[model samples]
Target: MSRQVTPRAAPFRQFIVKVHGRCNLACRYCYLYEGPDHTWRTRPAAAGPKVLDQTATRIAEHAARHTLTDLSLVLHGGEPLLAGAARLAAFAERVRERVPRGCVVHTTVQTNATLLDDRRLAMLARHGVTVGVSLDGGRAAHNTLRVDHAGRPSWPAAVRGARLLAERYPDAYAGILTVVDPASDPVETYESLLTLRPPALDLLLPHGNWTAPPPGLPGRGTSYGDWLCTVFDRWWSAGRRETRIRLFEECLALLLGLPAATESLGTEPFTAVVVETDGSIEQVDSLKSAYEGAARTGLDIFRHSFDQALNHPGVAARQTGIAALSAQCQACPLVAVCGGGHYAHRYRAGHGFTNPSVYCTDLQRFIRHVASRLRESAALTSGGATR
Candidate 1:
């Protein structure tokens, strides 16, 4: 099959660096460790200085080539904190030094929050590194799936870490990221996150594909959509917009004919790339959920430029908009808004990635719910204007 080429000129604006390839916790559903990908077994536990230097140089070259004024450098991991504070600080500094003087570099670290300490927090703060924590909800039960190696519950430590960040480093506390649990009460989950007073939050659907479909998805049901809609209604009715919910806001924005800023939805060219601990330049790490080595690009910062990775077949497929979607998706009215629901969630063994999301029904129901709410809001506004 001929590969589809994206019409728009896409450039690399985000780089997710896997500073550590080993995790302290053993989350039951982690797409990297617990999923199909076993490539992490061969990687160094932490990225060495040489890998960091080459990655920094490549990022600088990519920025200069694209004339990108702003770039987002995300410190990712099996657990980034496991790489130690000194390594992370040095890596961030090295990248910052290599970037062009005029380019703005926004650095962020996404952690499970178990290892956060006053000293580590201080170090990250000094470097202007924003921290994003992963917490399922406010209660222990909500986070039972996220446990340590011995299967001990990690909620207490995780919550403690989050509280410390919020109280001590409010400015540096970016927000929280929660993987959606359809079985959990959406309102309870949302309220629990409110306790941390996060500036923003993301509700991620469990990573799954057509072959190994996500849990709680029945053949004819839309439990995920129902769960999210309940949360949406509660958040919408609150009207204060107390905290920014990324998934809801992105969907609403797309519904309003605005450009989507997230890869979860819309046809926005995916500009994010991953640098594994072994210096492998790969597609988004999430692709590992699809199959073993699904993310590998046979490219590395040490030998290949970011521009070369951009032309990669996997990268090009994601940026190609409607051309990359399955036939059913192309004919659907919601195609522009849904954007086929994250590239990794459309995979199957025989068919490749040219398929609708495994969450198609849920997405359809959720989008329609949001659209209904939008129409109601518009009606109210029009009524007030005429009155």
Candidate 2:
């Protein structure tokens, strides 16, 4: 038997605040709207003042209890921009005010980018809220999947908004988040995003599970791995870190035996929590991709502390490291670097989250490729040093 791993009592360092429950655009792949979860149908269109106040209070109390010095608050959504600029500014300021002395709060908003205007940008900047936009890739073809409710393309508006942010509020422009579509040419995709000139970019795997599974994935092939490796080669050979690709950088760091910075591929305890629009405290919202209520804790910011939500079984399991993984995963050599993939990707109805990620083979292939490149680089460095 693998040695048991204990859950670390870490305080929440990131809080994802769902300021709006409905989105203007209806992206077909949205887990919240298109997935099995229907809970959003019952939630209010936007978070009210009461919910924001209680959420701020709960976060402050949690920080004090844990003695946390730094925390990040992400204004998230159906589309956080739907909450309007004034409300978002007020919410961010309220949270900042409630934080205890010496505790720093970094606020950011992740938006679909269609609603971003100069006025909204000014408001967000005034409140010190960094803006992150989601763009699938550089070209309109690359963003065909990200469309509107009327089946119209949203790329033009999104691109326009992204450009405005990059040009007007460069410092406050956090970065871009793109979901990898294996069908898109990796180099083209990378270059397309370069047009926006984001300070950083996150290449996210489409959230899927064993039961539901992500689109375009074959029954037994590493299409995603191959695609990412192509991008990796291009980025690696560039001879300079032009743009920060979160997943690639994190993988390289982990391969070099350094700490990974992201939750997607690390043994670091999961310290992020989500507050839904209705004041419900939940685990990371990604769990909604697993099934209905997969992310729920039955705790609300109004009545419960973040500490109480931390003790929920689902939340605790994610922090337990290898003990929470299946036997197959614990024995794998790449377990440490892959961290058995994201917790939500490991779900199956009968086996639960104990299984290895649905993308196990792809993860193995990608990690090995990165490790091999690192080893080759190390060998050349050592040889040059000796000579």
lDDT of each: 0.90, 0.87
Q: Clashing pairs in model 2?
A: none
lDDT of 2 by residue, 24-75 (tens): 8988778889889899998888898899999999999888877789899999
Q: How many residue pairs clash in each candidate?
A: 0, 0
Show model 1 residue runs off by greater than 4 Å: 1-9
Instruction: Give RMSD to native, each candidate.
Output: 2.5, 3.4
Instruction: Name model 2 segments beyond 4 Å from true.
Output: 1-7
Candidate of highest TM-score: 1
lDDT score, candidate 2: 0.87
RMSD in Å for model 1: 2.5
Candidate 2's error at 163, in angstroms? 0.4
